[model samples]
Target: MEPLVRLHGITVRYDGRRNGGLVAITDVDLDIYQGEVVGIVGKSGSGKTTLLKVLAGLIRPVKGEVVFNNHKLNGNSFRVGVLFQSPLLLPWRTVIKNILLPIEVLGEDVSKYLSRALELIEKVGLKGFENSYPWELSGGMQQRVALCRALIHRPSLLLLDEPFSSLDAITREEMWMLLQDVISHEGCTTVLVTHDVREAVLLCDRVVVIGGKPGRVRAEVRVDFKRPRDLKLQYTKEFNDYVVMVRGLLGD
Candidate 1:
């Protein structure tokens, strides 16, 4: 099967205060298949987010090519839904309005997307709070709204960077389940960039481990777990084994 998105020879560098530039990533190649979750895991300053930014077309690689559905990413209107560490919701916008924010930005018909926005709110279990402001919701609830906002446009790809890191352990677990359900329902291919080895092993079909100052793909682990996986699987030897393997690759 062909990849929905492909990155070949990806390399990024940042201009340091000194003359010489700092390389964030070097000579990385990646493939994201349709209807699969791919996790990129690494320690802080390991260039994980930099790689994700390359995938999102937010950062142009110093040397690489990004192909989305066989087309070059540049000069193309790529539809991607991104959820960051923070919910990043507008303080004044209501839940429904916030979900529709993407539509507004895209200059699409708001009325046409209202039903979809409401449907997403319900899907994420944010019903009856559609009119509530961001401040009114709990941290998890606000993230739920953010999830709704991300999927509002039915993006071809979903890019999540430390999305559940802000929540408590229990809330984070709950979100893992919720996200799995929503991704299955929406059939959205996802790329998750996280430092949590356990999270990657549990959630991704494949985990890519990155390391070094100018990060490069160190190892790739394929998870053959069945869909709709139970949280109980975490306690099983197989689950922990994958986690341990990924962690080992990161030199944890």
Candidate 2:
């Protein structure tokens, strides 16, 4: 199948004045197909986040091109959705109102997306909290609201940057399951940037290991485990082997 998104020869450089001339990433190439999840794993400053920013069109690469469905994205033209480690919800807005912000920003019909907002709230386990403010919810619930906001627009591609990094272990695991369910049902292509090797192995169809100072793809591993995988699968030898392999690629 043709790739839904492609990054070809991507390179990024920052002004030396800002961070003393940091070369964030260079010559990185990747392809993501419809309904597939790709994990980009790297250490701090490995340019994993930079690569994602380039792909999402949040930042322009110093070199190379990003192609989405055969069309070259000029300065982030794709229908992209992003989730950061923090939920980043507006403090004043209610849960439903928070989700509707995108529609308002895009100048789309609020009424048209209203039902979607409500449905996604419920889908992410936030049904009754529509009128609740961000401050009232627990960390996990807040993140659920954030997920709903990202999906409210029904984007073609979703970018996640260590989104569960802030939560406690039990909550993180719950969020992982919730995210997998949402993506599987929505059929949205996703790119997850995470340092958690086990999380990568659990959630991704393929894991792309990034190495070097100016990060590039060091290895790519395909995971053929069955769909709707559970925690028990993590104990299997195949899963452990893949984790060890990825860890090795990361120079662990």
Candidate 3:
């Protein structure tokens, strides 16, 4: 199958005022297949988020190209949807209203997408709470609303940056399953940037380990385990081996 996204010789650098220098992520190349979940794992300042930003066209790479669906991505393209670490919901608006926010912003007919938004809210397990405000929902529920907002436009590519990082362990696992179900049903290409190795291994078809001062692809592990994978699979020796291998690669 042809890759939905391919990053070639990508490089990113950050210039902070106090410690201005080449801040990691150099010569990184990757390929993400359509309908596949690709997880990127690394420690803090490993440029994991930077790589996602580059792929999302939120920031331009100093070098190399990001090709999505066989075409080089331009900075202004709106073909992708992004869900940040935080829900960024409009506290003043209700959950359904927030989900419909994107359509309203695009100046499209919100009525056309209102049904779609409601469907996604239900899909993400936020069904009965549509009329509730963001403040009324728990952290996990808030993240569910965010996921619905990201998918309201039916974007071909979904960029998830630590979408469940803030949740508790049990809630995180629940959200992981929720996300897997969503991806499996929607068949959208996903690139997730997460710090949790276990989450990456459990949720993604392929795990890319990024490391070093100027970050690069240190390791790539394919999870051959069958789906629908659940919490039980995480305890198997094969899963443990992959976790250890990734941990060693991350130099943690």
Per-candidate RMSD, Å? 1.0, 1.1, 1.4
TM-scores vs. true structure, each candidate? 0.98, 0.97, 0.95
Judging by lDDT against the true structure, name the best candidate. 1
Q: What is the C-alpha lDDT of each candidate?
A: 0.92, 0.91, 0.88
Model with the higher lDDT, candidate 1 or 2 = 1
What are the per-residue Cα lDDT tens digits for candidate 1 across 63-134?
989999898888436899999999999998998999999999999999999998888889889889999999
On a 0 to 1 TM-score scale, where does candidate 3 land against the true structure? 0.95
- Best model per TM-score: 1
Per-residue lDDT of model 3, residues 1-252, tens digit only: 778888999998777778875756999999988888999999988999999888778888888998877888888564677898899999999999998888888788999998888888878877789899999999999999989888988888899998888889999989989999998888888999999999999998899999888889998989887888888889899999989988888995
Model 1 has how many clashing residue pairs? Answer: 0
**In candidate 3, which residue ranges exceed 4 Å CA deviation?**
17-21
* Tens-digit lDDT string for candidate 2 (1-252): 889988899999988876777788889989999999999999988998898888778888888988999999986466888999999999999999998998899899999998888889888887788999999999999989988888888888999999999999999999999999999999999999999999999999999999899898999999889899898888999999999989999985
Cα deviation of 190 in candidate 3 (Å)?
0.7
Better of 2 and 3 by lDDT: 2
